[model samples]
Target: MMTDLHVVPARRGRAVRLAKGQAIQIINTHGQQVVDTWCFNADDMSEFMSMEHLHATLQGIFPATGDGLTTNRRRPILILEEDTSPGRHDTVIAACDVHRYAALGCTQYHDNCTDNLRAALGHLDLRTADCPAPLNLWMNIPVSPDGKITWGEPLSKPGDHVTLRAALDCIVVMSTCPQDMIPINGAACTPTEVHYRLIA
Candidate 1:
Protein backbone atom coordinates (compact mmCIF):
# COMPACT_ATOMS: atom_id res chain seq x y z
CA MET A 1 0.00 0.00 0.00
CA MET A 2 1.07 3.56 -0.54
CA THR A 3 0.86 6.38 1.94
CA ASP A 4 0.01 10.04 1.40
CA LEU A 5 1.39 11.45 -1.81
CA HIS A 6 4.04 14.15 -1.70
CA VAL A 7 5.08 16.77 -4.18
CA VAL A 8 8.50 17.89 -5.30
CA PRO A 9 7.79 21.38 -6.51
CA ALA A 10 9.32 22.73 -9.64
CA ARG A 11 12.83 24.19 -9.21
CA ARG A 12 13.08 22.68 -5.73
CA GLY A 13 13.75 19.45 -3.84
CA ARG A 14 12.37 17.16 -1.16
CA ALA A 15 13.80 14.38 1.01
CA VAL A 16 12.11 11.34 2.50
CA ARG A 17 13.27 8.74 5.00
CA LEU A 18 12.55 5.10 4.29
CA ALA A 19 12.93 1.97 6.36
CA LYS A 20 14.43 -1.17 4.93
CA GLY A 21 11.98 -2.93 2.60
CA GLN A 22 10.02 0.21 1.91
CA ALA A 23 9.91 1.81 -1.50
CA ILE A 24 9.39 5.23 -3.01
CA GLN A 25 7.29 5.80 -6.10
CA ILE A 26 8.42 8.92 -7.93
CA ILE A 27 5.98 10.08 -10.54
CA ASN A 28 6.81 12.22 -13.48
CA THR A 29 3.56 14.06 -13.23
CA HIS A 30 4.19 16.24 -16.23
CA GLY A 31 6.52 13.66 -17.82
CA GLN A 32 9.29 15.90 -19.06
CA GLN A 33 10.74 17.26 -15.83
CA VAL A 34 14.01 15.67 -14.76
CA VAL A 35 14.34 14.67 -11.13
CA ASP A 36 17.84 14.57 -9.75
CA THR A 37 17.94 11.82 -7.11
CA TRP A 38 20.32 10.83 -4.31
CA CYS A 39 20.27 8.38 -1.42
CA PHE A 40 22.28 8.29 1.80
CA ASN A 41 22.51 5.88 4.72
CA ALA A 42 20.44 7.35 7.55
CA ASP A 43 22.92 6.45 10.23
CA ASP A 44 25.97 7.42 8.20
CA MET A 45 25.73 10.35 5.85
CA SER A 46 29.10 9.60 4.26
CA GLU A 47 27.77 6.42 2.74
CA PHE A 48 25.64 7.56 -0.15
CA MET A 49 24.54 6.16 -3.47
CA SER A 50 27.58 6.62 -5.68
CA MET A 51 27.21 6.72 -9.45
CA GLU A 52 30.86 5.69 -9.89
CA HIS A 53 30.44 2.67 -7.62
CA LEU A 54 27.14 1.88 -9.29
CA HIS A 55 28.80 1.99 -12.70
CA ALA A 56 31.42 -0.53 -11.58
CA THR A 57 28.89 -2.73 -9.78
CA LEU A 58 26.33 -2.85 -12.56
CA GLN A 59 29.03 -2.97 -15.24
CA GLY A 60 26.90 -0.46 -17.11
CA ILE A 61 25.75 3.15 -17.05
CA PHE A 62 21.98 2.66 -17.26
CA PRO A 63 20.40 0.86 -14.33
CA ALA A 64 17.28 -1.16 -15.00
CA THR A 65 14.64 -2.83 -12.87
CA GLY A 66 16.10 -5.27 -10.30
CA ASP A 67 19.54 -3.68 -10.45
CA GLY A 68 21.04 -2.75 -7.09
CA LEU A 69 22.14 0.85 -6.66
CA THR A 70 25.45 0.68 -4.86
CA THR A 71 26.99 3.03 -2.32
CA ASN A 72 30.50 4.40 -2.09
CA ARG A 73 31.48 1.40 0.01
CA ARG A 74 30.22 -0.80 -2.85
CA ARG A 75 27.13 -2.11 -1.08
CA PRO A 76 23.56 -2.04 -2.25
CA ILE A 77 21.52 0.77 -0.78
CA LEU A 78 18.49 0.61 -3.04
CA ILE A 79 17.00 -1.53 -5.76
CA LEU A 80 15.44 -0.36 -9.00
CA GLU A 81 12.16 -2.15 -8.35
CA GLU A 82 10.10 -0.86 -11.25
CA ASP A 83 10.34 1.57 -14.11
CA THR A 84 7.33 2.48 -16.26
CA SER A 85 9.16 4.86 -18.50
CA PRO A 86 11.81 4.03 -21.11
CA GLY A 87 14.31 3.14 -18.36
CA ARG A 88 16.70 5.81 -19.56
CA HIS A 89 17.89 7.36 -16.30
CA ASP A 90 21.31 8.99 -16.62
CA THR A 91 24.39 8.11 -14.56
CA VAL A 92 27.09 10.22 -16.19
CA ILE A 93 26.20 13.84 -15.44
CA ALA A 94 27.07 15.78 -12.32
CA ALA A 95 24.34 17.66 -10.49
CA CYS A 96 24.06 21.27 -11.63
CA ASP A 97 25.54 23.89 -9.27
CA VAL A 98 26.15 27.60 -9.04
CA HIS A 99 29.48 27.20 -10.76
CA ARG A 100 27.77 25.39 -13.62
CA TYR A 101 25.28 28.21 -14.00
CA ALA A 102 28.03 30.80 -13.95
CA ALA A 103 29.84 28.90 -16.64
CA LEU A 104 26.60 28.89 -18.58
CA GLY A 105 26.78 32.70 -18.61
CA CYS A 106 24.54 33.52 -15.70
CA THR A 107 25.47 36.84 -14.15
CA GLN A 108 23.60 36.22 -10.88
CA TYR A 109 22.91 33.24 -8.64
CA HIS A 110 20.56 30.63 -9.97
CA ASP A 111 18.59 27.69 -8.58
CA ASN A 112 20.40 24.43 -9.08
CA CYS A 113 20.18 20.77 -8.09
CA THR A 114 23.26 20.90 -5.85
CA ASP A 115 21.84 23.60 -3.64
CA ASN A 116 18.45 21.94 -3.73
CA LEU A 117 19.96 18.75 -2.31
CA ARG A 118 21.67 20.64 0.48
CA ALA A 119 18.54 22.62 1.27
CA ALA A 120 16.38 19.52 1.28
CA LEU A 121 18.66 17.74 3.75
CA GLY A 122 18.84 20.85 5.88
CA HIS A 123 15.08 20.65 6.30
CA LEU A 124 15.60 17.40 8.21
CA ASP A 125 18.40 18.88 10.30
CA LEU A 126 20.92 17.00 8.23
CA ARG A 127 24.03 18.14 6.38
CA THR A 128 26.72 16.55 4.27
CA ALA A 129 30.13 17.79 3.24
CA ASP A 130 29.95 16.62 -0.35
CA CYS A 131 27.45 16.26 -3.13
CA PRO A 132 27.67 13.01 -5.02
CA ALA A 133 26.63 12.73 -8.64
CA PRO A 134 22.88 12.23 -8.85
CA LEU A 135 20.77 9.70 -10.69
CA ASN A 136 19.24 11.93 -13.36
CA LEU A 137 15.76 10.51 -13.76
CA TRP A 138 14.10 11.17 -17.12
CA MET A 139 17.02 13.21 -18.37
CA ASN A 140 18.19 11.99 -21.75
CA ILE A 141 21.80 12.39 -22.78
CA PRO A 142 22.47 10.24 -25.80
CA VAL A 143 26.00 8.91 -26.23
CA SER A 144 27.67 8.41 -29.59
CA PRO A 145 30.05 5.54 -30.36
CA ASP A 146 32.91 8.05 -30.59
CA GLY A 147 32.50 9.26 -26.98
CA LYS A 148 30.12 12.11 -27.66
CA ILE A 149 27.00 12.87 -25.69
CA THR A 150 24.09 14.98 -26.87
CA TRP A 151 21.36 16.37 -24.63
CA GLY A 152 17.89 15.29 -25.59
CA GLU A 153 14.37 15.78 -24.35
CA PRO A 154 12.70 13.25 -22.05
CA LEU A 155 10.91 10.34 -23.65
CA SER A 156 8.53 9.63 -20.78
CA LYS A 157 4.89 10.55 -21.02
CA PRO A 158 2.88 12.25 -18.33
CA GLY A 159 2.39 10.23 -15.11
CA ASP A 160 5.19 7.77 -15.83
CA HIS A 161 7.00 6.72 -12.65
CA VAL A 162 9.75 4.62 -11.12
CA THR A 163 9.76 2.76 -7.83
CA LEU A 164 12.97 2.36 -5.84
CA ARG A 165 13.10 0.03 -2.85
CA ALA A 166 15.35 0.77 0.05
CA ALA A 167 17.92 -1.94 0.72
CA LEU A 168 18.94 -0.20 3.93
CA ASP A 169 17.35 2.39 6.15
CA CYS A 170 18.09 5.45 4.09
CA ILE A 171 17.13 8.96 3.09
CA VAL A 172 16.18 9.60 -0.50
CA VAL A 173 16.20 13.06 -1.99
CA MET A 174 14.64 14.33 -5.20
CA SER A 175 15.11 17.63 -6.97
CA THR A 176 12.92 18.90 -9.77
CA CYS A 177 15.68 20.15 -12.07
CA PRO A 178 15.52 23.88 -12.80
CA GLN A 179 17.70 23.83 -15.88
CA ASP A 180 15.97 26.33 -18.12
CA MET A 181 19.18 26.91 -20.03
CA ILE A 182 18.94 23.58 -21.77
CA PRO A 183 16.39 21.21 -23.24
CA ILE A 184 17.15 18.41 -20.81
CA ASN A 185 13.77 18.74 -19.15
CA GLY A 186 12.01 19.08 -22.48
CA ALA A 187 12.28 20.84 -25.80
CA ALA A 188 10.62 23.84 -24.21
CA CYS A 189 13.12 23.83 -21.33
CA THR A 190 10.43 24.16 -18.68
CA PRO A 191 10.59 22.22 -15.45
CA THR A 192 7.42 21.00 -13.77
CA GLU A 193 6.34 19.43 -10.50
CA VAL A 194 6.44 15.71 -9.66
CA HIS A 195 4.59 13.54 -7.15
CA TYR A 196 5.77 10.66 -5.00
CA ARG A 197 4.63 8.32 -2.26
CA LEU A 198 6.05 5.89 0.24
CA ILE A 199 5.10 2.27 -0.28
CA ALA A 200 5.02 -0.33 2.42
Candidate 2:
Protein backbone atom coordinates (compact mmCIF):
# COMPACT_ATOMS: atom_id res chain seq x y z
CA MET A 1 0.00 0.00 0.00
CA MET A 2 1.24 3.48 -0.89
CA THR A 3 0.91 6.04 1.90
CA ASP A 4 0.47 9.69 1.18
CA LEU A 5 3.37 11.98 2.05
CA HIS A 6 2.90 14.14 5.14
CA VAL A 7 4.94 17.00 6.59
CA VAL A 8 5.39 17.78 10.29
CA PRO A 9 7.15 20.70 11.89
CA ALA A 10 10.11 20.92 14.24
CA ARG A 11 9.58 20.36 17.96
CA ARG A 12 6.57 18.36 16.85
CA GLY A 13 5.92 14.60 17.20
CA ARG A 14 4.92 11.83 14.83
CA ALA A 15 4.37 8.10 15.20
CA VAL A 16 4.30 5.52 12.45
CA ARG A 17 4.08 1.80 11.88
CA LEU A 18 6.29 0.65 9.02
CA ALA A 19 5.79 -2.75 7.53
CA LYS A 20 8.69 -4.82 6.28
CA GLY A 21 10.02 -3.36 3.03
CA GLN A 22 8.44 0.05 3.66
CA ALA A 23 10.51 3.22 3.79
CA ILE A 24 10.26 6.37 5.92
CA GLN A 25 11.94 9.70 5.37
CA ILE A 26 12.64 12.08 8.23
CA ILE A 27 12.94 15.46 6.62
CA ASN A 28 14.79 18.37 8.15
CA THR A 29 12.45 21.05 6.95
CA HIS A 30 14.48 24.08 8.08
CA GLY A 31 17.77 22.26 8.56
CA GLN A 32 20.31 21.98 11.40
CA GLN A 33 17.88 20.18 13.71
CA VAL A 34 18.11 16.70 15.15
CA VAL A 35 15.38 14.08 15.07
CA ASP A 36 15.39 11.52 17.89
CA THR A 37 14.16 8.20 16.62
CA TRP A 38 13.51 4.72 18.03
CA CYS A 39 12.15 1.45 16.69
CA PHE A 40 10.83 -1.88 17.96
CA ASN A 41 9.87 -5.19 16.49
CA ALA A 42 6.10 -5.24 16.03
CA ASP A 43 5.95 -8.89 16.86
CA ASP A 44 8.22 -8.78 19.91
CA MET A 45 8.57 -5.57 21.85
CA SER A 46 11.38 -7.04 23.92
CA GLU A 47 13.61 -7.19 20.87
CA PHE A 48 14.83 -3.64 21.16
CA MET A 49 17.56 -1.63 19.39
CA SER A 50 21.29 -2.12 19.77
CA MET A 51 23.41 0.88 18.85
CA GLU A 52 26.60 -1.07 19.40
CA HIS A 53 25.70 -3.67 16.84
CA LEU A 54 24.57 -1.10 14.35
CA HIS A 55 27.81 0.80 14.66
CA ALA A 56 29.77 -2.41 14.41
CA THR A 57 28.03 -3.46 11.25
CA LEU A 58 28.25 -0.03 9.71
CA GLN A 59 31.95 -0.02 10.68
CA GLY A 60 32.10 3.73 11.08
CA ILE A 61 30.98 6.68 13.15
CA PHE A 62 28.04 7.82 11.00
CA PRO A 63 25.31 6.06 9.13
CA ALA A 64 25.49 5.95 5.34
CA THR A 65 23.67 4.31 2.51
CA GLY A 66 23.82 0.50 2.58
CA ASP A 67 24.52 0.45 6.33
CA GLY A 68 22.38 -1.93 8.32
CA LEU A 69 20.72 -0.73 11.51
CA THR A 70 20.65 -3.71 13.84
CA THR A 71 18.62 -4.57 16.92
CA ASN A 72 19.71 -5.68 20.37
CA ARG A 73 19.68 -9.27 19.23
CA ARG A 74 21.97 -8.41 16.33
CA ARG A 75 19.13 -8.53 13.85
CA PRO A 76 18.83 -6.10 11.01
CA ILE A 77 16.06 -3.61 11.70
CA LEU A 78 16.43 -1.05 8.95
CA ILE A 79 18.72 -0.16 6.07
CA LEU A 80 20.07 3.28 5.35
CA GLU A 81 18.72 3.97 1.91
CA GLU A 82 19.86 7.56 1.57
CA ASP A 83 21.73 10.33 3.39
CA THR A 84 22.64 13.90 2.66
CA SER A 85 25.76 14.33 0.52
CA PRO A 86 27.64 16.53 2.97
CA GLY A 87 25.78 15.95 6.23
CA ARG A 88 26.85 13.35 8.75
CA HIS A 89 24.60 12.05 11.51
CA ASP A 90 25.65 10.94 14.95
CA THR A 91 24.55 7.64 16.44
CA VAL A 92 26.43 7.97 19.72
CA ILE A 93 24.30 10.73 21.15
CA ALA A 94 21.51 9.16 23.16
CA ALA A 95 18.03 10.58 23.36
CA CYS A 96 17.38 13.44 25.72
CA ASP A 97 16.12 12.73 29.22
CA VAL A 98 15.52 14.62 32.45
CA HIS A 99 19.16 14.40 33.50
CA ARG A 100 20.53 15.95 30.32
CA TYR A 101 17.82 18.59 30.47
CA ALA A 102 18.96 19.77 33.87
CA ALA A 103 22.58 19.90 32.77
CA LEU A 104 21.70 22.03 29.76
CA GLY A 105 19.82 24.66 31.77
CA CYS A 106 16.69 23.72 29.86
CA THR A 107 15.05 21.52 32.41
CA GLN A 108 11.75 22.89 31.30
CA TYR A 109 12.28 21.22 27.93
CA HIS A 110 12.63 17.89 29.68
CA ASP A 111 9.26 16.70 28.55
CA ASN A 112 9.58 17.85 24.96
CA CYS A 113 11.34 14.83 23.49
CA THR A 114 9.85 12.47 26.03
CA ASP A 115 6.37 13.71 25.29
CA ASN A 116 6.89 13.14 21.60
CA LEU A 117 8.13 9.63 22.17
CA ARG A 118 5.23 8.77 24.44
CA ALA A 119 2.75 10.23 22.02
CA ALA A 120 4.26 8.29 19.15
CA LEU A 121 4.13 5.08 21.12
CA GLY A 122 0.57 5.71 22.20
CA HIS A 123 -0.42 6.15 18.58
CA LEU A 124 0.72 2.58 18.00
CA ASP A 125 -1.10 1.33 21.12
CA LEU A 126 2.22 0.82 22.86
CA ARG A 127 3.34 1.93 26.31
CA THR A 128 6.33 3.86 27.64
CA ALA A 129 6.90 1.08 30.10
CA ASP A 130 9.18 -0.40 27.47
CA CYS A 131 10.55 2.68 25.79
CA PRO A 132 13.95 1.98 24.23
CA ALA A 133 17.04 3.97 23.37
CA PRO A 134 16.70 6.29 20.38
CA LEU A 135 18.84 7.38 17.43
CA ASN A 136 19.63 11.04 16.77
CA LEU A 137 19.45 11.77 13.06
CA TRP A 138 21.09 14.85 11.47
CA MET A 139 22.90 15.71 14.68
CA ASN A 140 26.52 16.66 14.00
CA ILE A 141 28.80 15.74 16.88
CA PRO A 142 32.42 15.46 15.91
CA VAL A 143 34.76 12.97 17.55
CA SER A 144 38.47 13.61 17.63
CA PRO A 145 41.02 11.04 16.53
CA ASP A 146 41.80 10.58 20.22
CA GLY A 147 38.14 9.76 20.91
CA LYS A 148 37.13 13.11 22.40
CA ILE A 149 33.70 14.12 21.16
CA THR A 150 32.46 17.67 20.82
CA TRP A 151 29.03 18.94 19.85
CA GLY A 152 29.54 20.56 16.49
CA GLU A 153 27.52 22.81 14.24
CA PRO A 154 24.62 21.52 12.19
CA LEU A 155 25.65 19.60 9.08
CA SER A 156 22.25 19.51 7.41
CA LYS A 157 20.50 22.13 5.37
CA PRO A 158 16.96 22.97 4.38
CA GLY A 159 15.24 19.95 2.79
CA ASP A 160 18.02 17.61 3.97
CA HIS A 161 16.82 14.17 5.08
CA VAL A 162 17.70 10.61 6.00
CA THR A 163 15.75 7.71 4.59
CA LEU A 164 15.49 4.23 6.09
CA ARG A 165 13.89 1.05 4.80
CA ALA A 166 12.36 -1.29 7.33
CA ALA A 167 13.76 -4.79 7.38
CA LEU A 168 11.03 -6.01 9.68
CA ASP A 169 7.55 -4.94 10.66
CA CYS A 170 8.38 -2.17 13.13
CA ILE A 171 6.94 0.64 15.20
CA VAL A 172 8.89 3.89 14.77
CA VAL A 173 8.71 6.67 17.33
CA MET A 174 10.32 10.04 16.67
CA SER A 175 10.69 13.58 17.94
CA THR A 176 11.45 16.61 15.80
CA CYS A 177 14.30 17.72 18.05
CA PRO A 178 13.72 20.81 20.19
CA GLN A 179 17.28 21.17 21.44
CA ASP A 180 18.16 24.83 21.79
CA MET A 181 20.79 24.50 24.52
CA ILE A 182 23.39 23.01 22.18
CA PRO A 183 24.96 23.57 18.79
CA ILE A 184 24.13 20.10 17.58
CA ASN A 185 20.73 21.14 16.29
CA GLY A 186 21.75 24.77 16.00
CA ALA A 187 20.93 27.44 18.55
CA ALA A 188 17.36 27.56 17.31
CA CYS A 189 14.90 24.80 18.05
CA THR A 190 13.33 24.62 14.63
CA PRO A 191 10.85 21.95 13.51
CA THR A 192 11.09 18.97 11.09
CA GLU A 193 8.81 16.56 9.23
CA VAL A 194 8.48 12.85 8.46
CA HIS A 195 7.47 11.62 5.01
CA TYR A 196 6.38 8.03 4.38
CA ARG A 197 6.21 6.09 1.12
CA LEU A 198 5.85 2.43 0.22
CA ILE A 199 8.50 0.82 -1.95
CA ALA A 200 7.66 -1.75 -4.58
Candidate 3:
Protein backbone atom coordinates (compact mmCIF):
# COMPACT_ATOMS: atom_id res chain seq x y z
CA MET A 1 0.00 0.00 0.00
CA MET A 2 1.43 3.37 -0.95
CA THR A 3 -0.90 5.47 1.12
CA ASP A 4 -2.94 4.96 4.28
CA LEU A 5 -4.84 7.83 5.79
CA HIS A 6 -7.29 7.98 8.68
CA VAL A 7 -10.14 10.46 8.36
CA VAL A 8 -11.11 12.02 11.63
CA PRO A 9 -14.66 11.52 12.89
CA ALA A 10 -17.30 13.71 11.23
CA ARG A 11 -16.80 16.48 8.66
CA ARG A 12 -13.28 15.34 7.77
CA GLY A 13 -12.02 14.07 4.41
CA ARG A 14 -9.07 13.64 2.01
CA ALA A 15 -8.27 13.25 -1.68
CA VAL A 16 -5.60 11.56 -3.77
CA ARG A 17 -4.50 10.85 -7.32
CA LEU A 18 -4.39 7.29 -8.58
CA ALA A 19 -2.67 6.15 -11.74
CA LYS A 20 -4.30 3.69 -14.07
CA GLY A 21 -4.12 0.18 -12.58
CA GLN A 22 -4.02 1.59 -9.09
CA ALA A 23 -6.72 0.83 -6.54
CA ILE A 24 -8.13 2.23 -3.34
CA GLN A 25 -10.09 0.77 -0.43
CA ILE A 26 -12.48 2.70 1.80
CA ILE A 27 -12.74 0.93 5.11
CA ASN A 28 -15.57 1.24 7.55
CA THR A 29 -13.32 0.87 10.56
CA HIS A 30 -16.41 1.37 12.64
CA GLY A 31 -19.78 0.40 11.23
CA GLN A 32 -22.59 2.84 10.47
CA GLN A 33 -20.44 5.38 8.68
CA VAL A 34 -20.98 6.57 5.13
CA VAL A 35 -18.17 7.59 2.82
CA ASP A 36 -19.16 10.33 0.40
CA THR A 37 -16.93 9.65 -2.60
CA TRP A 38 -16.12 11.37 -5.90
CA CYS A 39 -14.01 10.37 -8.88
CA PHE A 40 -12.69 12.61 -11.69
CA ASN A 41 -10.54 12.14 -14.76
CA ALA A 42 -7.04 13.33 -13.98
CA ASP A 43 -6.43 14.57 -17.49
CA ASP A 44 -9.65 16.56 -17.84
CA MET A 45 -11.67 17.77 -14.93
CA SER A 46 -14.76 18.05 -17.09
CA GLU A 47 -14.85 14.30 -17.60
CA PHE A 48 -15.87 12.75 -14.30
CA MET A 49 -17.52 9.61 -13.04
CA SER A 50 -21.23 9.67 -13.85
CA MET A 51 -23.84 7.86 -11.81
CA GLU A 52 -26.40 7.98 -14.58
CA HIS A 53 -23.96 6.25 -16.89
CA LEU A 54 -23.32 3.52 -14.36
CA HIS A 55 -27.02 2.84 -13.83
CA ALA A 56 -27.53 2.47 -17.57
CA THR A 57 -24.55 0.17 -17.99
CA LEU A 58 -25.42 -2.01 -15.06
CA GLN A 59 -29.06 -2.19 -16.09
CA GLY A 60 -29.75 -2.12 -12.41
CA ILE A 61 -30.23 0.41 -9.64
CA PHE A 62 -26.95 -0.24 -7.84
CA PRO A 63 -23.40 -1.11 -8.83
CA ALA A 64 -22.06 -4.59 -8.22
CA THR A 65 -18.62 -6.11 -7.97
CA GLY A 66 -16.91 -6.34 -11.35
CA ASP A 67 -19.18 -3.59 -12.70
CA GLY A 68 -17.25 -0.73 -14.24
CA LEU A 69 -18.05 2.92 -13.64
CA THR A 70 -17.77 5.33 -16.55
CA THR A 71 -17.36 9.01 -17.19
CA ASN A 72 -20.11 11.22 -18.54
CA ARG A 73 -18.90 10.51 -22.06
CA ARG A 74 -19.13 6.78 -21.36
CA ARG A 75 -15.38 6.37 -21.06
CA PRO A 76 -14.18 3.84 -18.50
CA ILE A 77 -13.28 5.24 -15.12
CA LEU A 78 -13.37 2.68 -12.29
CA ILE A 79 -14.02 -1.03 -11.87
CA LEU A 80 -15.56 -2.33 -8.71
CA GLU A 81 -13.12 -5.01 -7.59
CA GLU A 82 -14.15 -5.99 -4.09
CA ASP A 83 -17.07 -5.34 -1.84
CA THR A 84 -17.34 -6.57 1.71
CA SER A 85 -20.52 -4.68 2.38
CA PRO A 86 -24.00 -5.36 1.02
CA GLY A 87 -23.34 -3.05 -1.94
CA ARG A 88 -26.43 -1.03 -1.06
CA HIS A 89 -24.65 2.20 -1.91
CA ASP A 90 -26.27 5.38 -3.15
CA THR A 91 -25.76 7.72 -6.11
CA VAL A 92 -28.86 9.89 -6.10
CA ILE A 93 -28.29 11.87 -2.94
CA ALA A 94 -26.47 15.16 -3.23
CA ALA A 95 -23.77 15.99 -0.75
CA CYS A 96 -24.85 18.18 2.15
CA ASP A 97 -24.18 21.86 1.41
CA VAL A 98 -24.33 25.19 3.22
CA HIS A 99 -27.91 25.80 2.07
CA ARG A 100 -29.01 22.53 3.59
CA TYR A 101 -27.58 23.46 6.96
CA ALA A 102 -29.11 26.89 6.67
CA ALA A 103 -32.51 25.37 6.06
CA LEU A 104 -31.99 23.32 9.21
CA GLY A 105 -31.62 26.59 11.13
CA CYS A 106 -27.88 26.22 11.65
CA THR A 107 -27.17 29.44 9.77
CA GLN A 108 -23.68 29.44 11.24
CA TYR A 109 -20.87 27.63 9.48
CA HIS A 110 -21.09 23.87 9.88
CA ASP A 111 -19.06 20.95 8.66
CA ASN A 112 -20.62 19.33 5.63
CA CYS A 113 -19.83 16.80 2.92
CA THR A 114 -19.89 19.36 0.11
CA ASP A 115 -17.39 21.62 1.81
CA ASN A 116 -15.29 18.70 2.96
CA LEU A 117 -14.95 17.49 -0.61
CA ARG A 118 -13.82 20.93 -1.77
CA ALA A 119 -11.32 21.12 1.05
CA ALA A 120 -9.87 17.77 0.09
CA LEU A 121 -9.66 18.80 -3.54
CA GLY A 122 -8.28 22.24 -2.79
CA HIS A 123 -4.67 21.14 -3.32
CA LEU A 124 -5.63 19.89 -6.75
CA ASP A 125 -6.97 23.29 -7.81
CA LEU A 126 -10.48 21.93 -8.03
CA ARG A 127 -13.63 23.66 -6.83
CA THR A 128 -17.02 22.57 -5.56
CA ALA A 129 -18.47 23.11 -9.03
CA ASP A 130 -16.13 20.43 -10.34
CA CYS A 131 -17.58 17.88 -7.97
CA PRO A 132 -20.33 15.61 -9.18
CA ALA A 133 -22.70 13.32 -7.35
CA PRO A 134 -20.68 10.89 -5.23
CA LEU A 135 -21.03 7.20 -4.61
CA ASN A 136 -22.38 7.03 -1.09
CA LEU A 137 -20.57 3.95 0.17
CA TRP A 138 -22.34 2.01 2.91
CA MET A 139 -25.22 4.45 2.89
CA ASN A 140 -28.80 3.29 3.27
CA ILE A 141 -31.54 5.05 1.37
CA PRO A 142 -34.48 3.06 0.17
CA VAL A 143 -37.10 4.20 -2.28
CA SER A 144 -40.63 2.93 -1.95
CA PRO A 145 -43.01 2.08 -4.75
CA ASP A 146 -44.63 5.45 -4.13
CA GLY A 147 -41.31 7.09 -4.97
CA LYS A 148 -40.68 8.22 -1.42
CA ILE A 149 -37.11 7.96 -0.21
CA THR A 150 -36.38 7.03 3.38
CA TRP A 151 -32.87 7.34 4.81
CA GLY A 152 -31.56 5.02 7.46
CA GLU A 153 -28.40 3.80 9.14
CA PRO A 154 -25.75 1.99 7.18
CA LEU A 155 -26.27 -1.74 6.62
CA SER A 156 -22.52 -2.32 6.86
CA LYS A 157 -20.81 -3.86 9.83
CA PRO A 158 -17.53 -2.82 11.36
CA GLY A 159 -14.48 -3.56 9.19
CA ASP A 160 -16.58 -3.78 6.04
CA HIS A 161 -14.90 -2.27 2.98
CA VAL A 162 -15.15 -1.75 -0.74
CA THR A 163 -12.33 -1.49 -3.25
CA LEU A 164 -12.15 0.10 -6.67
CA ARG A 165 -9.58 -0.15 -9.44
CA ALA A 166 -8.84 2.84 -11.60
CA ALA A 167 -9.77 2.04 -15.18
CA LEU A 168 -8.12 5.28 -16.13
CA ASP A 169 -5.83 7.68 -14.36
CA CYS A 170 -8.05 9.68 -12.00
CA ILE A 171 -8.41 11.50 -8.74
CA VAL A 172 -10.46 10.27 -5.77
CA VAL A 173 -12.07 12.78 -3.46
CA MET A 174 -14.17 11.94 -0.45
CA SER A 175 -15.58 13.10 2.86
CA THR A 176 -16.26 11.32 6.09
CA CYS A 177 -19.81 12.62 6.24
CA PRO A 178 -20.50 14.66 9.38
CA GLN A 179 -24.24 14.52 9.18
CA ASP A 180 -25.31 13.89 12.73
CA MET A 181 -28.68 15.40 12.02
CA ILE A 182 -29.70 12.51 9.81
CA PRO A 183 -29.66 8.73 10.05
CA ILE A 184 -27.77 8.27 6.79
CA ASN A 185 -24.66 7.82 8.91
CA GLY A 186 -26.06 5.89 11.90
CA ALA A 187 -27.21 9.02 13.64
CA ALA A 188 -23.62 9.66 14.78
CA CYS A 189 -20.45 10.41 12.83
CA THR A 190 -17.12 8.69 13.25
CA PRO A 191 -13.69 8.38 11.69
CA THR A 192 -12.87 5.88 8.96
CA GLU A 193 -9.70 4.67 7.23
CA VAL A 194 -8.88 5.09 3.54
CA HIS A 195 -6.21 2.80 2.11
CA TYR A 196 -4.65 2.84 -1.34
CA ARG A 197 -1.98 0.95 -3.28
CA LEU A 198 -0.88 0.22 -6.82
CA ILE A 199 -2.23 -3.21 -7.69
CA ALA A 200 0.36 -3.82 -10.36
Q: Which candidate has the top score in lDDT?
A: 1
| Global lDDT scores for all candidate models | 0.96, 0.74, 0.79
* Residue 152 miss distance in model 2 (angstroms): 1.2
Assess candidate 2 and give its lDDT. Answer: 0.74
Order by TM-score, highest first: 1, 3, 2
Residue pairs with backbone atoms closer than 3 Å in model 2 (clashes)? 9-192, 10-191, 10-192
Residue 158 lDDT (model 2): 80
Query: What tens-digit string does per-residue lDDT give for candidate 3 at 112-154?
Result: 8888888888877866575588888888889899979998788
Q: What is the per-residue lDDT of model 2 for residues 4-120, given as tens digits with 9 covering 90 to 100? A: 667556676677788898888777767766788888888987776667777787787677788778998998888888876465777887776677788877636455677678777
Per-candidate TM equals 0.99, 0.87, 0.90
Give candidate 3 regions above 4 Å deviation. 1-9, 189-200
Cα displacement (angstroms), candidate 3, residue 32, comes to 1.1
Which one is best on TM-score? 1
Estimate the lDDT of model 1: 0.96
Clashes of each: 0, 3, 0
